[model samples]
Target: MIKKFLLTMCLLAALAVGGFLYVKQSVTDFIAQPLKIEQPHLVTVERGNNLNTIISKFVDDQWINPTQFSTLVRRFHPNLTQIKVGTFEVLPGMTFEQALNTIINGKEYQLAITFIEGSTFKEWREQFKQAEYLEHETDGLTEAEIARQLGIEHDKLEGLFLAETYHYSVGDSDLDILKRAHRKLDVILEQSWASRQDKLPLKNSYEALILASIIEKETSVPSERERVAAVFVNRLNKRMRLQTDPTVIYGMGDRYDGNIRKKDLREATPYNTYVIDGLPPTPIAMPGKASILAAMNPENSNYLYFVASGTGGHVFSKNLRDHNRAVQQYLRQLRSKK
Candidate 1:
C-alpha cells in the first residue's frame, strides 16, 4: 500500500510539470504571431495621450485582443511612456511587438511635401494635390478654403507660408500643411521684426514686408538689396512715383500677358506705380531674409533710380539725367557686346 501511494504522488507531479510547460509554450506562440489586418489603419496619439489611451485605440480598431494586448505590450516594451505622439500608419501582419517598436522608435512612415519659394497660390494647390499624404483625384480645395480652415484670413495668407520641406502622414489635410508653414513663417517674422532698425519709412511691419518683396523681385544679388532699398527710399522721400516695373506688372493683374507693353504702362491701376504714388496695394512676392533686413535698414544714398545693367547687377543714378545717360551707356554697351 505504501509503494502504490508513492507511485501515485510521482504521477501527479509529472502531470503538473507538463501543464506548466504547455502554458509557457502557448504564451510564447501568442506573442510571436502576427496580427492580420484586412486594411491599412492609422492611429493618432495626441500630444497628451497616455499609454491607456493608445492601448484602447488598438483594441477599438480590432488590431489586438483587449484581454491580452496590454500585458503583451508591457512585456515586450518596458518603456511605454516613450511612444511618440503623432500620426502613425498601422500595416497588416504586424505583431504587437512590432507595433510597439514602431511607435517607440518613431518608425512610422512619413509623407513629404515641399513648397518652393515664389510659387503662386494656384501653383501651391497643384503641388499639394500631388502629395502622398493627400488623396489623389479628389477635387482640391482652393487657397481661400485652405486658409479659412486653418483660421487664417485670405489676405493674410499671401507670402505668409515659408518655403521648406514638410512631413505628414497619409490623409493629412491641405490646411494642415499650410498651418505648419504659416507657423514657421510667423516665428521667423517675429524674430526679424523685433531686431529691425528704428525710424524706418515703413508705417508698419506689413509695409516693410511689402518693400522687401519689391527688393526681392528687383534683384537676386545679396549685395544689391541694400542699394535697391535705398533707391526706393529716395523715391519715397522725394514724393516721386516709384515707377517700379514690377508694380506695373502687378497692376496688369491676371490679364498680364507675357510682354509689358506701352499700353499697360499708360493704363491706370491701383498697383501701377507709374500712375499712382507711394507703395502698391499689396506685396508682389515673398521676400527672403536678406531682402527683409535690407528694407528695414536701407543704405543711405542719393540714388533715385536703378536700371538693370546687362550683367546681373543694376546701374543706379542720382537723377533722371544721369539715369538716362547710364541707360544709354548700358544699352549701347549691351548692343556692342552682342
Candidate 2:
C-alpha cells in the first residue's frame, strides 16, 4: 500500500512539471513570434507620451498582442520613460522588441524640403519659415547681413542655393541648413565647372551661374532651359542686352507690387536687361541643376531673342524680325484669350 501511494505521488509530480514546461514554451513562442503588419504605417509618439499610452497605441494598431507586449515592455524596457518622441516608420514583420529598440535608440526622422528651380530668396525664406519643425522669427539681418552669415560676399544669395529636396533632422537651425545647402552647391558647381565644354562665352563659373539664373527665371518648362540659355549665350557673344523681364522684377526689389509695368521695363536699374547691356550685376533667383548645366553647355543655335508664348513657355528666334513676329503672335493670343 505504501509503495503504491509513493508511486502515485511521483506520477503527479512529474505531470505537474511537464505541464509547467509546456505552458512556459507556449508563452515564449507567443512572445517571440514576429508580428506581420500588412500596410505601411506611421507611429508617432508625441512629446511626453507615457509608456502605457505608447503600448495602447501599439495594441490598437495591431502591432502586438497586449499581454506579451506589456510583459516585454516591463521586462526589457524598464526605462520606457526615456523613449524620445517623434515619428517612426514601422516596417512589416517587425517584432515588438525590434520596434521598441528602434524607438529607444534615437533614430533620426528624415523630412524633406524641396526648393523648386527659379524660386526667389524671399519665397525660399517664407517656405522655410512655414516649415513645422523650423522656428520662425523676424530675421533682423539685411540681405547683405544674411550673405555675410552665409560666408558669401555678394548681397544676393539668389542663384547660390541649388534647388533640391534636402533632408534634415527634427530641429535643424535655418542658418545651419542653408550653410549645408550652400556647401553642397559649391561641390556640385565645382564638378560641373571642371567638366564644362571649353571656350564658352562665360568668363568664369560665377558668370555661368549668372546666365543659368537668367535661364531658370525665363522658363518653367524643362525642355526650354537649354534654348533659353542658347539665346542668352548668343546675346553675350554679340555684347547685347539679355532684355529679360525677370531682371526688371529683381531691380524693383521690395517696391515691386507684383506688376511689371512698361515704365519698370524702361527704367534703368543695375539689373534691368531691357535698359542695360551684358549680364546683370547679380543673379535674380536661384537656379536648379538643369539650368546650370544648360548654361554650361548651351544648345548650339543662332537664337538671340525669345518671348513668352502664353502657353507657359517661350518662343525662340534667331533674328530680330522673327522675334518681333513671335512677340506679336503671343500678344494677339493673350488679347484674344482675355
Q: Candidate 2 lDDT, tens digit per residue, 1-338?
A: 99999999999999999976765665455446566688746667778786667777877867777663354445444655466688676677777656666677747566678888788888889888777566443267777888888889878788788778888766566777788778877887777788787778877888888888888888879999888888888888888888888899899989799899999998989999999989987778888888888888888889988898888888888888999999999989989998
Error of 2 at 108 (Å): 2.4
Candidate 1 lDDT tens digits, 136-199? 4325655566567777765445566666788877657777777778787667667767877766
Model 2 scores a C-alpha lDDT of 0.78
What 10-residue stretch in candidate 2 is worst by lDDT?
68-77
Alpha-carbon TM-score of each model against the true structure: 0.67, 0.73
Deviation in angstroms for 151 in model 2? Answer: 2.7
> Model 2: runs farther than 4 Å from truth?
1-99, 104-107, 135-138
Q: How much lDDT does candidate 1 score?
A: 0.74
Off by over 4 Å in 1: 1-85, 89-99, 107-112, 134-156, 161-173, 176-199, 325-338
Go through the candidates in order and give the C-alpha RMSD of each one to the true structure: 6.0, 5.7
Report the number of backbone clashes for model 1: 0
List clashing residue pairs in candidate 1.
none
